[model samples]
Target: MIKFNQLRKVFDDGTVALDGVTIKVEQGEFVVVLGPSGSGKTTLLRSVNGLVSPTSGNVRVNDVEVCEQSLRMVRRKVGMIFQQFNLVGNLSVINNVLTGSFSTYNKWYSNLYIFSKELRIRALAVLDRVGLLDKAYQRTDELSGGQQQRVGIARALMQQPDVLLADEPIASLDPMIAYNILSLLREISAEDKITVLCSLHQVDFAMHFAQRIVGLSEGKVVMDEPQKDLTAEYIRKIYKTHDKGLFFGPESKPYSDDQLVTWSEYK
Candidate 1:
């Protein structure tokens, strides 16, 4: 469902985000990208949806050339979720979700009128699927962090995307809330047959939910293995845990959401 060939992304400051990376994903498969800070995971995900254009190489999603296609066209079919829940603070929960359906709207009606009945009904159903239908009328800023994240997922689903790209989606929530969100994502992947490419920092959760894990470090793929074939050594290399002491004894670092949010200092 997705393909990347020699993809490279260099920022304006000459920082290379993705370095000649190439990968492919099949339809209906859930893959987890594992790496510490500065890896190419975020660049790769944005490239698939045309949010971050590749400097050279090609990115194809569902057989369409991502770089060549219009961003609106690619985004309509490829959904993305961020670590921070991206929603309009003033808009109602349902309205934020309806924004996701903007791609399916007609130029004339969407510009002059409100949402159509068909789109409204579909939005409600998607909100229900994400367990946020009852909160539809509430303002988005009124929601708890976890509920807001769920709102983000519901908004993405309303797009009816063929591929879902989640960039450290659960990194902001507490462990229990994080688990709930991950489980919901997994359920959606199974029931909807949506291809999921989620980047995660939590090793245990990635191993638990993802069928295949791809590890990147220093802008390169260090380990790509099925869950059953992975080990501690492989994880350590990707995360660089040797001198970090995060995996040490009882006094070691704890896996807190705050730490995940403040990733610039993970080392």
Candidate 2:
């Protein structure tokens, strides 16, 4: 569903955020990008949706090349979740979700808060899916961190997108809440048949939820393999060598190859 071919991104200051990165994700697949800060994870995700124009090479989604003219269509098929839960704090939860329909709404009508009854109904259903229908009338800032993130997820679902891009969606929450969010994302991906490409700092969460893991280091892909092939020792090595232990928490420990198990086996 998504393809990046020899993609490169260099800022005006000569910072190389992505260096000849290439990867592909099929429809209905859940892939996790594992990387530390400054490893091009965000850049890679942004490029897919045209938020960041590539300095070189191409990005294609669902067989369409991502460019200036195609961005509108591309974005309509893509939904993004931010780490900061990028919502208008004072807006009601329903209103926040309705913003996802901006691409489909008339500009004048959208500016006037004139959403159609159909949109409102759909928004409510999305909230219900995220277990937040009761909170629809509440202001976003009034919700808890996990709830707010759920609101974010519901907002993304408002697009009814075929692909979801989550950039460290659980970074601000507690470990348990983080697990809940990831689990919810996994369930949603399966139920909706939406392709998910999420970036994560935690190796354990990636292993638990992702069918495939792509490890990045120094703005390039260092490893891309199925979860079944991953070893705890290899994961530790990826973080230590690329991120200098920034992503590896205190509880991290290397497991022998014999202890490694595929996600399906774990289940």
* TM-score of model number 1: 0.88
lDDT scores for all predictions? 0.81, 0.88
lDDT of 1 by residue, 90-162 (tens): 8889888887777887766654437888888988998899898899899999998889989899989988998
Residue 45 in model 1: lDDT: 86
lDDT of 2: 0.88
Estimate, for each residue in 88-207, the C-alpha lDDT of model 2 and write its tens digit.
999899999999888878978987778999999999999999999999999999999999999999989999999999999999999788889999999999999999999997777888
Best by lDDT: 2
| C-alpha root-mean-square deviation, candidate 1 | 5.4
Those runs of model 1 whose alpha carbons end farther than 4 Å from true positions after fitting are: 107-113, 243-267
Candidate 2 segments exceeding 4 Å error: 242-254, 260-267
